[model samples]
Target chain A: MPVEGYAGDGHFRQTYNDIHILCQETAKRIKTEFNPDLMIAIGGGGFIPARIIRTFLKVSDSPESKPRNIPIQAIGLSLYEALPDTSEEVVGKEVIRTQWLDFSTLGDKNTKYGGLLGKRILVVDEVDDSRATLSYALQELQIDVEKQLKELKVSEEERSRIREATKFGIFVVHNKLKPKAGEISKDVAYFSGTDIEDLWVDYPWEMPDILKHDELKRQDDEMAVKAK
Target chain B: MPVEGYAGDGHFRQTYNDIHILCQETAKRIKTEFNPDLMIAIGGGGFIPARIIRTFLKVSDSPESKPRNIPIQAIGLSLYEALPDTSEEVVGKEVIRTQWLDFSTLGDKNTKYGGLLGKRILVVDEVDDSRATLSYALQELQIDVEKQLKELKVSEEERSRIREATKFGIFVVHNKLKPKAGEISKDVAYFSGTDIEDLWVDYPWEMPDILKHDELKRQDDEMAVKAK
Candidate 1:
């Protein structure tokens, strides 16, 4: 049952078809489920799924109206600590930020969610394993919103008006059912396309040998059909 | 031959396989040809291809070293103008920037680009139709580099040192052979996966009906084989 190179029952390499279908199906429910105005994608992993789901999130006011895509703000996070030189080193499990939201253009008064202050924002990622990255992103975003509110120096009532409108939600293609290393706020709306086992997920993008990876996926599908 | 819904001889729909192969093939050349240190992905369209290409570009220092991804900075641009209300409106062909580089987090002294001052940077996008967006991006980036140098008050010799090392390049999946609306700097290196005719390319992400879109692609490939 083991594929060459990737030898283990714990590894599950997925094909593009399944990921595409999952996004499409999830978008159908996400339409009414979250109905988010903005998306904060944890970069690299979240980029593809965010772009795919944006196709479904588009809305046109009328027959002639242009269907607009929901804006995506990419935030890059890595579980591993990158060394100064290109040498092998895995020192700690700390999260390092490579990128964050561009606040200048995004913070204009005319623009929606000025500095991500008050709007329905959805944080998207490929998978939720330790829940460390998601928790960090949400907490940082909350801090950003709070800081912006104070800096702008708006009236207390005016501040409360935006505060009530502001909300955060989460969407992931796969959420591994395991003991999470981090915690998430219960108040934030959560949606996962599929609940997966606490195993090693070999995403299509990370496959060094895609052909072999896909072949294994095909065989798995065939075995599943035969078993049924 | 024309297909239902998307009826036209000019509109060509691509399957995921073709796109994936194109990225793989292009990455092979990009490794030696461009040898870029960083990537600037034009969001949405560029997001998918950039992620795919990054998979191939990674290089580990040693047997135990982790193959690090060439960091991708996303910039968002759109051809259409967005209105306050969700109403139909076709504005000029001007490119509106939705997102730009995050100067704060990315401008660290130890960072690779050092505010993109002196580095081999590759700007990636899905297609090159009008050549307007790509041109604008390069020019703006040059301006940003100049502004940073001035603000930092870098010495003349030091400025020249980084400036000589600094270079810009481009990579796109499809480049339509047509008279471009905008012009690019001749000195800047350019790379396109494939040169396509002036046809409407329906990318995998834009397919509203993916099943039908893929079926049409299969039929097209079969016809090509039969003709051969």
Candidate 2:
């Protein structure tokens, strides 16, 4: 529960309030800069922040009417095996699932409610560790988006144009400063709430004894203050 | 965003800390009473608590091994016209999705991970206002579970046995104590974190101004104290 191997009060901890603020602050930039149409949250860890940030991402053209919530799709990702940095992803099929994802609910092109055709998609998670999971998500999403384009009976030029317009962005509460196992290209609009040295930071959700976790976190705060 | 027409400063606000504790406490009972295999979260509102509760519901077979996090399926649900108390629901297809849920990922009966065949299922949401959404979700899920049973070419007795074993439970953070628009049968094990009068309650996730919301919540606390 408290991150497998390191299962005690020895790890760095964060309060629920801090994480909520991080998501809120980052979402301000995402609304104006990225302007995503939909979001795909990597399950479990990403679920909390993805829902939190959506409150800020809501769009209301006119104040009189209700603000529209950005629809979010939560998906699962598991690493097959460590691959070479240059090699293409195996594209894990067990989780991505061709039965759905841009085929049924998300793929219905005509419906104003559905369709990922040329819409901007934001991929969210709690942290960017090795980035193996993030890389897998981005790769599979790119394939799915292209498949949606291919199904459409349109000219090659138009298909390419729509493909280009269908942008992808990455957002995570914490982006670790370390060599990643997977690589992300510069084309995607990447946004991170904050960057920190690679450290074991326990999310509030993972802590079974939250009060004690907060007490330890407070001690850390005191140490930093004393050092200063 | 703040529960439609009942917006602005006129709302009962809850802090993030309070909600987290509510979920953790409710989860303790859910763990003993109705141990769920997989969760189906009524999306947007349900997403937050569903994720939070999963953290506590996790099972660690051994201390050395990591605790298994319950997989969650976030789904969309919208009402199709207000039906009479006894009238049947016009099952909304734009959202229910036949392609997924107990069909693809959840339906693969052979895989230990997938099947909804005879597993305990938990349907989660933040608030149960009219019970329309929860009723809709339970009906669709019941239909889907039966469909899974029908697909298998088994004897009638065996099918009935499997159906009986499949249990369904409901969990919500807040339950408004009033006559609901939709009806829920007595069989389903229901759990709500707290019950309040039929008033507009503002969840932290929906707030645009969280600080102000918390401050108001603090005032409510003070008022409650003074009244006592």
Candidate 3:
């Protein structure tokens, strides 16, 4: 499934330590499964992923011990013409390169193959844009949808829908800024942007669901009444 | 002279930004008279001096450009045995090395030269340690006392006292656990540490002495009567 949402909220909004922990987990996963020649990260905010990868490299003790040769590279991809005025210094210091690719450049020729063809690409965004302008571009590049779906853990139903909708392509629509009808493909999955405030609120509740169980609730209520 | 105290409130302690402003102002006065090759920063928090130096580098546009140098070397002298556990990552990333030197290391003839000897040191601390063990160590290093005094903007009377005291040789009392007692020496000059609550209380009254001559007090009396 295409994960989309604000990273600062809910399950995504993570602390530096938390990001480090996730990196450790990812490093373990990579060690177990595929050791692709190169790991390509595509996103604007490159610090988090790059730091994670760096930390992983620091901690991981692969028998090969060839970290210097098999490097994890990150390339920033953005839709806007101008670079976003964010923490560029921090990002520049961390990432290899910042690439700007305009989706409009893909036109009818197909976008998938234009940049990310056979490369194992990791697509990151606040939300999944159904326009598929970026994803379609990748698909045209001869990227196998089945492989990507399996890797990303997308449900079989979602994979079937994506394969079926490959013909017409996709379009972009904004809930707040409504687009014309048929502008976007309905078959593609959409993820709501994660907001920081919402993440702050949801993080505590995301703890084991047992905290919300009837027994816990009754005990909490009894304690409160007794204290009162 | 060593300066200390919290800013705004005890809860919201003063930071490097606050100290940098004052350091810059002091730098302006002595910039022409004594061009410093190195700045020896003594106790505050490690971050504050690091920031002050960083800020200085930002504004400094001299031919030497002291700030941009890779090993922007400086010692962070403190009475504390260990440097406070802060995100030292800031120093490493910025490529600025703020080396920590314990005050206890001073006065041992066998010890290598550590404290500011001939360098135009900027001492930042809450209070002066009259016992002078640390100061004597620096003096033994053949540091130009006259030059240091001038850089510190010491008054003539203070200069004489420091010169005479140094002749006899001074020593700093070892009091890591408890606060030490001692007024600033003649060689030292004071910088006011930020106290926001005090500023809030004193600012209005600090207006022109001429304005305080008559009308303001009458207005205060009338206001007091109205409250009654």
Indicate which candidate wins on TM-score: 1
Model 1 steric clash pairs? none
Error of 3 at B75 (Å): 3.9
The sequence of per-residue lDDT tens digits that candidate 2 reaches over residues B98-162 is 12342555644333324677788899888887788888788888887787788878889988888
DockQ of candidate 3? 0.02
Q: Identify the superior model by DockQ, candidate 1 or candidate 2.
A: 1
Model 3 interface CAPRI class: incorrect
Candidate achieving higher lDDT, 2 or 3: 2
Which ten residues in a row are the worst by lDDT in model 1 chain A?
A: A83-92
TM-score of chain B of 2: 0.83
- The residue-by-residue lDDT of candidate 3 on A1-228, one tens digit each, is 212333321333222223334345554444344333333323323323332343243322366543331222222333331222221121112122123222222222222332222233332222222223334334432344444445544577865655553332111111122231123334333322221221122121112232243244345445546655
Interface RMSD, all models, one decimal each?
Answer: 4.0, 6.6, 22.7
Full ranking by lDDT = 1, 2, 3
Q: What are the lDDT figures for the candidates, one per model? A: 0.76, 0.71, 0.31
Which residue pairs of candidate 2 clash?
A: B102-B107
User: Comparing chain B with the reference, what is the TM-score for each candidate?
Assistant: 0.86, 0.83, 0.35
Per-residue error at A115 for model 1, in Å?
2.2
Give the fraction of reference interface contacts each candidate recovers.
0.42, 0.33, 0.00
Q: Kindly report which residue stretches of model 3 are placed more than 4 angstroms away from their true locations once superposed.
A: A1-228, B1-12, B15-27, B30-35, B57-119, B124-180, B183-185, B188-228
